[model samples]
Target chain A: MTTTVIEESFRPGELEVRPDGTGNLLGSRCRSCGAHFFPTREACAGCLSQDLDAVKFSTEGVLYTYSVVRQSTPAFEVPYAIGYVDFPEGVRIMGQIAGLEFDEITIGMPMTLSLEPFGENEEGDPLTGYRFRPAEVTND
Target chain B: MTDVHVVGVGMTRFGKHPDKDATDLGAAALLEAVADAGIDPRIIESAYVGHVFQGMVTGQRILAQVGLAGLPLSNVENACSSGATAIREASLAIRAGENDVVVAVGTEHLTSKFSGALTPDPSDPEAAVGATMPGVYAMRATRYMEDHGMTREQLALIPVKNKANAARNPLAHFRKEITVADVLESRPIADPLNLHDCSPVTDGAAAVIVMSDRAAKKYANGRGVRLAASALRSGSVDVTPTSMTFEPLTWATAQDAYERAGIGPDEVDFAEVHDCFSIAEVLRVEGLGLFEQGSYPWAVERGEADINGRLPINPSGGLIGKGHPLGGTGVAQVVELVRQLRGEAGDRQIEGAKVGLAHCRGGKAVGIEGAACTVQILIR
Candidate 1:
């Protein structure tokens, strides 16, 4: 008999992992000023309104800027492409760029969020995290 | 309100200190400051210390090491702006008539605390996504280059200029001059920012003695330079996506300093703006209104920012060339300012320097543009 390990979301509040392997990043949308914040906040910074609603962010975004990081902390491996992506909800999110060589990534490219294995949980279970890939590559 | 004057300043040689810890460095700097002021240690009414990664009550330990353990003391931590914040707190004590003489000290043993690229607090959302300090600055450099059409060669000039300045500073971490080609060919830490562009992890400390106007008249012995203004501001959460190349927090803090000092940016004779990364200097001076937007790179090529030029910037070599002991960086900037104003800077002195400016901005949160920023104007 073969046993399969179902992956859990690395951070349940930030990412939701559906049983079908499709999920969305979570954030807070200010009901008063219509502003969005990543990882959620109790009150809106724009208008200081506490009437915030948890919402899932759209996966597609435009690459604003990026860098090939050669040196980093111990947890992260070397030479990863990291970037800030501008979403339609007027928020800029930072993530690792996946599915492309370091030199091939460019500014203004459309990117889509891709859920992948992040690391092992404390109990040694597989955990899922997100990275941004080229939108066209996501289709492939 | 009483005017505040920096009667004396002291700083440790900025470099790796494998044998000494933060407490040792802090005590040495504090003693030097007291001696430089030529005052009895008993005259010091209070003290404030700034540091990061050093454990609690570090200020008390420094005071105890110096045998002044009983006075009221507070430890300050504002990331890289920690030392600058301590100075501001000391100035406030003088201005409020709460103390006649106060000492501000900033010390850090960064080499022992961290190595390689520094990151934000582990809990930050960006840090969770693998954001390192070098990576963040490199991304900004990329955006700045695209927005202004700045060449990579032009960017290389910044480290070259700073290292040459550092060669003249005996206390700097790197005392050898480097060429532009050296900068271009150095090991890459992050794309567009070579190893030369990043400030080294260093161990050091700096101290300043601020006195009330009355105290300066009695003990300053004609060596005091007026601290015209010391302004500090924390970054506000962005209401909207802002430009990555510009720094609004720097501008706001500088505006406060300029207003308090009744001085404009044009009157600045020299400056010691934080150059934690090469691109940081361009952002700082422009944000302070000392240079035009997208104009610093060309100005640097023309020698407009040299020690002998119209507006000398980072004459103490800045963080890139001198060293960056996160807590000590801000206080060291003011020490350079005081030395220049008093005409005591032997080899790297700006001629007839009357007014000097020092700026420090540090820390990175998830949504904030910057953590804390400080601008100080000193006049002779």
Candidate 2:
């Protein structure tokens, strides 16, 4: 058997963008309380459970709500859309909306997550970022 | 526990002040409050100063300007609720016999901070990646719309009403009247949320003097309002999913204050709630048990929360119409309520106003709707 390893500088809990361009978020689940946490938690917030399991969350969800950013912030590109998505697992996550015109992102639109490069750090290192894109529409 | 009474309240005109430093504004408000109470500076036993980002020893620096040397000083940072928390701490200290007369002041000079970095760091996994305060609040507005079938026109009415009220308040930062169409057509910051829906970044300060009941009587002008209750609560690290719905900390804090004051939400004639965004005012009204779920907007639409409504809200024009100076907002809310209770709010006063409530919540850390919430009730 041959083991393959990819060499890359990544932050802890840094999400890997799948070859398909979908961004799957990795998180930790508390064994004692069945609580899910994003960006992973060392210990369970509920019941102080130390037993935790690593899990990959679905990269797709319905657009809960969103806002068009007419203003720019250092952490984000100007004229972007940001919103919360309601995952199938009943969890809500916040992320940037990518690959869409400012007027196109609407509430209740289906979206798929994608991991991309965030801006660099003070030291000029490329930082990986997570954002969501509109999913393909299907005929009912 | 001993009773605490409010002796004096002071506030700078809330607005953009590029010329003033936080310490300068804070010290000015303190001096005014102490003078209003006719208390000597040497008599203040302790002080609590609330500020968001004034670097190390911020509280000490502000008090030192007011001749407060070696007095017990604590800096509080609870986001928008910072001022309320400082006041609560000082009142508790007095009740516990730790001090006789204490001053609680809040100040913010945001013009000095970088406006481009207003959002929390998104590199951290728990950060609100794409959401600013307006974005989170827009979600609630959407939910409210879905649950009640409210229209955008109804939501726009909130800002219009608040701005109208603010026009009469000389101390309000934005005193210009705005119409529904003005709000509807304003630049959109978030979907369904226009720039008018949000409060502007402001620079100002507010202060209050709280003394033990005996001291208060000696200093008050025979009409000073009583500090009926003050309560502070922090978010729980663990809780059931429903706990997130109510934001447990705010609920608990309001409950504690209402119980201690022996008053329910219905008894409140008017309230100054955290309205950093228009939706926040709706949420706070519901969260504080003033109205049923999904009914806040209806209440607003029907003029139930207007200056002349059944239960006026933000009569001094809230953060949305006034200005949110971060640390100064919470204390300013209390000051507005005090003026109303004392029948001194002038044009923005609620007729026959007696019991008044003020709430402030802030801190946008991960997994928490708010890092802290403070509630206070006043009576004449």
Candidate 3:
């Protein structure tokens, strides 16, 4: 039996991967102005404060807008869905949409981050990247 | 302080030049501009050249080609606003009394440098997750349609209008007119946006000569047009998530220009905006305060933006109709404004145009609303 060994994360600065295949996108939370930024930041843009903390973003967000990219560069496969999702942290992050048809994706839909197998690394080893999927709903 | 006047403007025909490079196009445009100004090349006190992807010292090569070396030169790159920023820099030199005459040239051999959908820098987080320029604009188009009740057909009319105008422009990239149906039926680049809805990868160059009032008096011979204002702004990081359908950066830039020029949007006789995509035109005109928000699609249907309509827009064919060679696009827009303001636009001319405006916004970062935005106003 062969097991696919996956890298920790495709991009270390933006995402954190766990051994069990669960991870959170990383960003910065400004200590001075309480503003949030994705992929981390050295300082806060709103207040120009250098005091910031690296923080993990929530697992879920709301879809702001989306498109089915029928054309792209060679690095990405064609006809993939991409979108901007608005997090409660006040930052909007862009990511590929999976687990749904392109037509099913719409603005204002609830989404959750899902870590999946991305492209291969230099030695052809598998890498883990993040995608946004429909958020699961539960009722008590 | 000295006032600046644009005494001469020239441009290479905007289209693909498989045989030529950026240096060739830049030199040709610079020489034509110097000749149009009817001044000895020795009087050109300085130069500013704008481009992207072209390697170091492209300006030096261009100046050497024209036998105008040794003049102070600076190469500029601000993404799509590169050429416009070059003009602004030249005007500043004249305004500050550092130089009496300066030339601003913008050239790009984009065909050799790029193909397919342009993306943000590879390091961008968005570009990492499969983001293309067309994909970004298409998302905006989708939201715009939902918010403003804009139909697909209504949006298609923008390319139709611009291409019809381009058909009359002898130097335009796509001189053949296209219909709304053509736009709808074109190859899909992204949902809600097609190949025809986007600007073509083009290679071209344009140059303009700006002089201090003293030099203009000595040589303009009554053909000089006052460059009332040149305004530029970089996008501010969003303090909060804002609507993607609106452009605060464009508005801020134009506000500075209008205030500086003492001209209102209502007085703008015509304009050349950065219509890199069909939807971009709607955002630009409205962002410049020329059209009301959510009102441009209806205005296009009413023929209000046509050449002879109430307020003509993109009479130069725009980036959609004209070719978009990044750095060249901004300078070409000013050249179009100069031509139209001087009643030299020929078949695509707007009659008795006294005020002309040009707007260019380019580049994309992960969180900012836009990268660079510029607004230049000229008065005849």
**What fraction of the reference interface contacts is present in each model, in order?**
0.76, 0.43, 0.77
lDDT of 1 by residue, B1-105 (tens): 999999989999999999999999999999999999999989999999999899899999999999999999999999999999999999999999999999999
The predicted structure with the larger DockQ, 1 or 2, is: 1
Lowest lDDT 10-mer window, candidate 2 chain A? Answer: A1-10
Write model 2 residue lDDT over B1-380, tens digit each, in one string.
77888888899999988888999999888988888788787889999999987777778988889788699899988777888999999999999998879999999997787462255545444343556667667666766676568789888888888888888799899999999999999988766788898888888999999988777767776756788899988875543233222446767889999999999988988898888778788778888998886787788878998898999988888888888889999889988988888888899879998899999888776555577888899988
Instruction: Point out the worst 10-residue segment of candidate 3 chain B by lDDT.
Output: B335-344
What's the C-alpha lDDT at position B81 in model 1?
A: 97
Segments in model 2 whose C-alpha atoms lie over 4 Å from true places: A1-11, A14-23, A99-109, A121-125, B114-117, B121-128, B237-248
Q: TM-score for all predictions?
A: 0.97, 0.92, 0.97
lDDT of 1 by residue, A1-140 (tens): 11222489888888888876778888899999999987799999999999999999999999999999999998888889999998888888899998898988899999998888776678998788888999985443
RMSD vs true structure, all candidates = 2.3, 3.5, 2.2
* Model 1: pairs clashing at backbone N, Cα or C within 3 Å: none
Alpha-carbon deviation at B178 in model 3, angstroms: 0.9
**lDDT values, one for every candidate:** 0.92, 0.79, 0.92
Clashing pairs in 2: none
